[model samples]
Target: MLYQLRNAGFTLVELIIVIVLLSIMSIATFSYLGFGAQIFSDVVGRDQLISQSRFAVERLTRELRNSLPGSARVINNNRCLELLPIHASSSYLELPQPGQTNADFVAVPPDNYSQGVNYEGTYLFVYANSEQRIYNSTTQRKVISGVTEQDSTLIFDYNTTPTLFPLQSPAQRYFISTGPVSWCLEATGEIAGQQQLVRITGYPLANSPDLAHGDAQRAVMASDLYNNIEGGQLPFFTIAATLQRANLVEIDLRFARRQGAEPFIIHHEVHIPNVP
Candidate 1:
């Protein structure tokens, strides 16, 4: 019996069979490990994209909500938004008219006016290529820029007839000019081939005929302003804006994630006030 066992152990064919089985197992294990690493990397990349998108949206929403309505004007042939805030006497101001570099303007206090008057306004300038900027009315210095471009829109001009107020009640207050403003922006490159789109709409301010209000205020009121003016089945993210008060605006942003093996989306809403 001992001799038979020794012969069985010494068989070269049996040893070769065991070696082949072990090799196959090692290959299979390595392959599985490699696959797992790939999946983990993909997941991390997707998460980073989602986080960046969310952060960009949130920052934009905040800036929009604080935008000043009266000071908001279209620039670059109605491709950008230039905003100026109200200013108090004794403050330094700058105005950027078409074809003009920062023209300086000083605020003079109304004669015989009492003190403690709030004389300041928020200024904003929005443009394509995912650029949103804020400026100080007094210093004429840039406050912020490059908020986020991952997904954004440039709203040009909008149409709406001025709302008429009762003659005996009060003067008609204008919020945002009503009408359709051409909105444009580039979607993410990764999803560019997938036909991604962004939908934008404006909400009329309460009792005001103007279209958008303060960025933050409008954002709050713009929650339900999406009407889908353009018809299509493309994957879309929605943005809405409305004027809440004379010096306040609100903005709403929603990132609609596409289904399938795609990155998740981040949604945001913010209110801004005192923007010119």
Candidate 2:
């Protein structure tokens, strides 16, 4: 048992080998984790973009659907989509058309009508066939001067003295609107190299869409749009109604995280089912 006592520890060569192995393992583990984290980050970014696009599209579609018939029009060279949202609609029992002295009409009260609800400043539209009649002609649009409920029917008086309407709805349907609403895609004034989608409200109804009106209320609906207008690409396209098809609104939006990020494009088609 008289053997020389050896050091009860690893040799220098053994320790060096163990250290090298640990270094390799650590490098590989961190690399894998870093790659997974990058993937997660990318997925999250994409999801957020999708959610924003979905909400904007859905809200725009809802308003278009509830708009007055034949009231959807694209102006500013397809940069803006203008619509007159209907507050209420009803079937009329009598309408004061052209050459009528009395500018009063009787209609069945709308389902949403409530007591003491003022109808002043609300416009009455009947048989609006084209964009011209809806926005340009005064006869086709009349402001409600008074509203009175009597025996389950409502009487609506017009501000116009004679109420010379150019056309009448064959279905006898009347649409009420407060004013025009517009969705416009424009360059962001504050943020450089980015575009913004904005909604214009309270602007005086005009024959053309006003991108900048001093009295209009503007709100940004979405940001980070990358639409290429100079390259013949527009955010909105209006397919006119034909005998074989109804009117269609094509919405093409391209979004990105930033200016140089990958673009996420969304295409939506909204059909106008309500015709004049």
Candidate 3:
């Protein structure tokens, strides 16, 4: 009976073998779990980048599609587009009168406040780091200092008079032109260690209120157009406009993603149906 009971129990060598097998299995399982965790983290990061890019594109597109003619103006020598709301109480449309040598505009008060100039509506004149800002009118404020000295190109395209006139010229000739005007802007510089290109389109809204304060004015119509392009690809985007006798305008926009990052793009377009 004693021999039978001893035989039934596991041998010391058998127990040792079982313990070694369990340890090996545990190590392999932990290694696999670690690998799986890393993969999951990578996938989540990629998804987040994609979602952010999509949201940006959708917002930009909606704004551009609603652009109106004669509602857009270029300030700071065409560095930025001054956009006005379609229907507003204030006289929001103001551009430097053509033919005037001065590069800035004078802020007409009572009808407009010089202090609220930046907020009442002004386009940010951003080049590299310098920002030359203005009011609803092209009135110049203190030049934005601390602009970084970087190699970059800013381009502006406008369908104005054939003659390249000076700023501060007569309003009739520069402000209320007989035809539509289109302006295109592009900037190039290093952002975050990568070379990038930024482009924008300006569409002027026709029937915009004159600088006169007595009459409620509609804001200028314009769009962001394009912002930052990398990797030699032109980024996918679209622009379209319609010109009637009352309205004149143009639109430009695009989408792009940074290099070595997940692919993403943002698009914007502005259209003003009634400008004449």
Candidate 4:
């Protein structure tokens, strides 16, 4: 009997079926990996947002806590908070008024100043209870010309014209300041038409809050800010001090990791002592 020779090879139908199965499996595998990658990206974005928001909030809180009483003012359409930072604070021994013979010297406890405390370019403030008193009134604010160390006291002398303080602190507290500090949420070009929170300093003290300056130093505190100011949602609000309460600063910051994404929001309140 003669046996016919048969070729041993995969048929066309079997090859096509195998190829289809392989394609389906590949698609499934890639889909799973893509889903995992998306999850990781979302998590990273959320963590980044939290970290940025926390730092900005904490810094603002600490600075506001140390600021002079009644010095906090919201300017620039409620987008900026301006205040004078206190470098040193203590009870004053003497403040020369206009009628007093010694119109140049202010005495304070010697221990308040450290060995490195520089008096140059600093200011002295007394009984600054309102924004007007802190910013506009010259009688309540004086620039320090020199500082002297005595046996048991520290004296700050003013070289400018001597004038009497309009009001005196009942607690006799005196506050020392270097200059004004401002925190503002403004637009920037770094992120393509996005707004960011910035801390500005090294600018001259102005009677009105200066909104823009070329020489001032600005540092970004937080990025991706999405606060809506025109819709009645403001980032900063000041609750004036009442007889029964202290001054309150309300901070509301809204951020987003990407454009068109839901915002991550933070609400904080800082209570400032009304001891001025």
Candidate 5:
């Protein structure tokens, strides 16, 4: 039998159809991949934001709990919290003997030395007489080891009424210095520029509440701080205290994104120690 060789290749129409099918499938796959990628990115970004916000709140809470007496106060329409932070908190030194004056001193342990407990450099100091936090320059200059009741190292004399001299039985009082680690909102940020919470270190060189208009020492503690008026949260920082009395601090934080989902709100109420 005379057998003829048949064409093994596909027809032109078949080839065209296959190409079209492949193109369609490729487009669908790419679209799916892109959607998946976008979802993943959103989830990661949201998680990061949540974690950052929580961390910021936790850190602030810890510091507030141990804040020096009469140091924590809300200012700037509750948009700021002014406080003389602490270094290595320690028990107040013992009272001096008869006719002996003991300056402001804490018998800090050797281990805490690394924490910059000494008053060698600029630091925040709060003592027996502090109804409002003030930035004292002269006080930052003197830092002699050991407590001397007379001529204390810590700053005394405040513009506020009923100025404080050397505290009586100060050992029971609370005095804290930011000790290099301070707090400031950033001058610029991705979202909350000049308003983002930051951690400042070794700041307030001359000791003055008049914080620099634009400081670079601040490190971002949180971004997108909510200062809205919707939740009855007046300012970012609010303080309620009496002269040489108890203080009530209210910190309202809200984080909302311009894009993506809605933001979150966090509130913390902090009361200083040594309430008499």
Candidate 6:
């Protein structure tokens, strides 16, 4: 009687093939996503390591540069560096007599040196016959009004001969300059039991290396301060004497995410202008 309409559907074989292809594609997509996630994790970790380490190194550099002439010391045995950071500076326009605030000194700080040390206040030991500090808590500036002794500047005591200032007694040793200062670095358990570069800062006795270690003012400047470093390579800092004092500083910093991760090494030889 009539040409009946017939519905056409996918055959069983074709349906099976389509399912197999879809399964394969899904598996591939998931695999790709997982791989991408791992890559992202590694990238993030490395970046984080870099940022933390770089900050520490920059801080160290700043402190080293800001250190009073010839105050940076690297204790080889402890793998630590010590420095007396300058609070502020003004040129010694003319040696001012006692009780003179308006002397010819017009705060001639070095390049990038802060101007606050003189007026703003610091724990600076004025060079009278003996070191003296006139500190005003409110102003946070050392008042040098009554201090006698023409050379009230902090720079004093040069190591005329070879000296080995060890970490055990940093304050007792003769520093390049005698004033408030402290030390740190290559310390263990500073960051997650991992070796880290630390910055130790504080006001210690002028010539008492023994009392120099007050407390670790700053810690973990750069965690993982090592990256397979070895041989003529200082993993952190080294202070070598030129002439009679520690004038040349060599810093070797190695950054890495993990034990076997790629290393980022930064090495610098800094010759301090202030070091006498």
TM-score of each: 0.38, 0.84, 0.35, 0.90, 0.66, 0.56
In order of lDDT, best first, we have 2, 4, 5, 6, 3, 1
**TM-score-better candidate, 4 vs 5:** 4
lDDT of each: 0.32, 0.83, 0.34, 0.82, 0.52, 0.48
Please give the lDDT score at residue 227 for candidate 1.
20
Off by over 4 Å in 6: 1-21, 76-78, 90-183, 187-193, 206-215, 227-232, 236-246
The order of the candidates by TM-score, greatest first, is: 4, 2, 5, 6, 1, 3
The candidate maximizing TM-score is: 4
Residue lDDT tens for model 4, 141-234: 8888778877667777765444567566888888888899999999776665468999999777777756566768889998888787888779
Q: Supply candidate 3's per-residue lDDT for 173.
A: 17
Span of 10 residues, lowest total lDDT, candidate 5 = 155-164
List ranges where model 5 is wrong by over 4 Å.
Answer: 75-78, 88-129, 133-182, 187-195, 205-210, 213-216, 224-235, 242-246, 257-261
Estimate, for each residue in 40-77, the C-alpha lDDT of model 3 and write its tens digit.
Answer: 98787666655544554454344433333334454433
Instruction: Give per-candidate clash totals.
Output: 38, 0, 33, 0, 14, 16
Off by over 4 Å in 3: 1-20, 66-276
Q: Please, what are the lDDT tens digits per residue for candidate 2 over residues 122-163?
A: 888887756878898887788888899888889987766346
- lDDT per residue as tens, model 5, 1-276: 999998788889999999999999999999999999988987887787788988987888787666555566544444556665555444434422235554223333323444323443333243433442333433222233332223232322223222223334335433435442445443244553224677655444333444444543556788765555434654345354565545666767666666313767677776666542
Evaluation by lDDT, superior candidate among 1 and 3: 3
Candidate 6 TM-score to native: 0.56
Q: Against the true structure, what is every candidate's RMSD? A: 15.3, 3.3, 15.2, 2.4, 6.3, 10.1
Clashes, model 4 = 0
Residue-level lDDT tens digits of model 6 in 1-276: 899899989999999999999999999999999999999999998888878866766776777676665456555344666666665444333333345554432222334443232322233222211111111121111223322223333321212111211111112111122244433445464444246765555554333344335552554566665533334445545454455554567777766666535878777676665322
What TM-score does structure 1 among the candidates reach? 0.38
